[model samples]
Target: MPIALLLAVPLTRAPYILSFSFLLLIYLTLAESYDVLSGYSGYMNLGHVCFFAIGGYTLAVIVTKFSSFPLALAFLLSPLSATIFALFISYPLFRLRGAYFAIASLALGILLYYIFVNPSFDWLAGGMRGLMINTSENRSIISYYLAVSIAIIAILTHYSIPKTKLGLALLAIKDNEDVAKTFGIAPYRAKTQALVISASIAGFAGGVYVYGIGYVNPLTVLNTEILLTPVVMTLIGGTGIYSGPLTGAVLLMIIQEVLWVKITHFHLFIYGLILVLVGLFMPGGLLRQTQIQKIITRLKG
Candidate 1:
């Protein structure tokens, strides 16, 4: 039903509607991607946005360098680059556990942000000025559908992971890494697999995002808010379940949109306060709240 509504959104021919829905799908894609590793495996990756940034910049560079290259082919390279980077970094990054891993990931994101914006890389990444691409007349609509496809893929990946060995390994590791290892679960391999999947989805989504906008810049792709939204949405929606990130993405996106439009002056403060309150009172997330659980039970009944 929701999918039907999303499919019909473009028919409205409303610019704001298309734009809003596109942004929502993008967030949903990222949140679900983040949930693949962090929600199931208990690895809080604060630098997950690094993949998104890399994906966007990669596509930007490709199009800039090979203007005649097929855009479809260039888009594919975005996720490939992100996946390669994730595979390369997973070894050392996965070695750290708990907050150490989280902080290191966060630092990694910051480091990449600076690297993309550095003057030395201008020939490739265009430095702080960013890269601009020639967008086609129908790019927005095409990108919107592409974003939808990636979001669907992310949702299916989240739904399907738990039924597989990797899923079991992730859940086991989340419960206790040492115990999981004793049970024959290769923690490093499982975690790496999850990260690689998450990175690829995020990369693809980021590519669609930049392609939609026809621009890529460090501030746009690697901003602090961009880095944090997926984490916040996944946590607030509830982890360890398929609906958690989806719930959080829809709820928070709506609330944030409303706040930004209505309470423009204090929206950020209000947003932060709401998150603080959720943390204090519903640390298990909205899905795990007793009231919500009862509601779900009633619906199922």
Candidate 2:
């Protein structure tokens, strides 16, 4: 698939297809990261995009202010910065549960959005004007590889977790926090670690995205689509399965492309419809179907 994508880049006259492919890769990483916390550990983090925003902003600030800085250094520090922010907030945020936690995450995202856009922070965050990355011939290709690496990491982490002790503890916590606690599992530790891991992956992807796109504004970098799309893709493909996010990202992205070609302005409307239908007819998600599950099992075996 990756080879096909690379080949398609120069073969096709339309350059936007490559753009869409990059987005698909980004979504795959984001979806997998969300599944780690919200799917496996069962924490709905609406503010997850804040980490993505932070990573992109981190890299953007460095590149914009210091043109001579090494790109590798910027990328490294971006996700690291996100991890620090995640650790600082994880303990207090994890204390909330269910709807309250969801609300808190939403509030946190909004707060960060305003912080970046506010006039007071213009010197630091670039305010509404935001940051512009220098464009280059290899930028898209570089972005593609960076996103691919992160996507691989996200999926592999998701796949390996279910086979480990931490995975079992996370599943137990997801199924019943109190019961997991009774079994001597530290719920706070497990959840916080998962959140940090999720945030870190998302941050890395965001950095890749900004690099590819060649610009970063608060509205674009901190878009809520980052939050909703991952959750929707994860749920549609079936949470708790390692490949669910990958399938969901592929299926939904293709659907979105089709919609964009056909309806254009109404693509978002159709996206919402697809999400509703998935919720109504297939609560467990498309991949959880018996036939599909069997095929996946055989392939894995």
Candidate 3:
């Protein structure tokens, strides 16, 4: 799939499609990472994008301050930095259940955005002025490759979860944490690990994104769209499996790109319409369409 995407980049030779694919890849990673927690573990993290910003800002700081660092090291450090932050916050955040946890995460993200945007914090981050990272002539190509790599990693992580004890514990907890605890599955441990993994992937994606954009501001890196779009994509795709988020991201990106070219203000309306229709009839997502299931069954048969 990655190879096909890479090959298609040049074969089509259309600059806009390449841009669309870049957006698609970024959202695909975000959606899949969100699914690791919200979909499989049934924990809605409304502020999943915080980790993305963490990674982005971390990369920006590193690359900006220490210009001699290897690009690969900067990329690796971004997600690692986010994962470290995730570990610190997971314990306290996981204590709350349902809406409380969701709201807390949302608040945390907003708080970070405002704090970083403050001029007083310019020493830590760039505040309102933001930071611009050095870029190369082939920066776009590099960003695309990095985005593709992270998206693949996110998908692999999703696929791998169901195969491990941690994944089983997550699934068990998703169904019922109390029951999972009774089964000797450590819910706290599993939840923390899930959060860490989810955050790390998001951070990695953010680092790539900052490199792509050539700048990182609080608003640009930590936007509400980043926080919400993954939720929408995960819900639309089918939460139970890996392909669901990918499907959701691809479809939505295409729709947004195609429509925005014709009707500049149609994306949100279309999202609302899709959500409404999904809520009315296809809550299980496109992967769960009756025909899709039947075809899968027959193919396996």
Query: By summed lDDT, which 10 consecutive residues of candidate 1 come out lowest?
Result: 262-271
RMSD of each: 1.0, 2.4, 1.9
User: In candidate 3, which residue pairs get closer than 3 Å at backbone N, Cα or C atoms, i.e. clash?
Assistant: none
The per-model lDDT (C-alpha) reads 0.92, 0.85, 0.87
Residues 1-301 of candidate 3: C-alpha lDDT, one tens digit per residue:
8568564684586777767778788889999999998887888898898899999998899999999889889999999999998998998899999899999989998988998999899987988889998888888878987888889899999988889888889899988999889989999999999999999999999999989889899888677766678888887788869999999998878777777788867677776887788778877788889898899889999
**Model 2 root mean square deviation, Cα atoms:** 2.4
Q: How far in Å is the alpha carbon of 191 misplaced in model 1?
A: 0.4
lDDT, model 1, position 115: 95
Q: What are the models' TM-scores?
A: 0.98, 0.91, 0.93
Candidate 3, residue 220: lDDT: 86
Question: Comparing 1 and 2 by TM-score, which wins?
Answer: 1
Model 2, 171-229: lDDT tens per residue?
99989999999999999998888888888998898899889899899888676765578
- Model 1, 191-241: lDDT tens digits are 999999999999999899999989999999998878888988987899878
Q: Give model 2's TM-score versus the native structure.
A: 0.91
**After superposition, which runs of candidate 2 have C-alpha atoms over 4 Å from their true positions?**
1-14, 294-301
Off by over 4 Å in 1: none
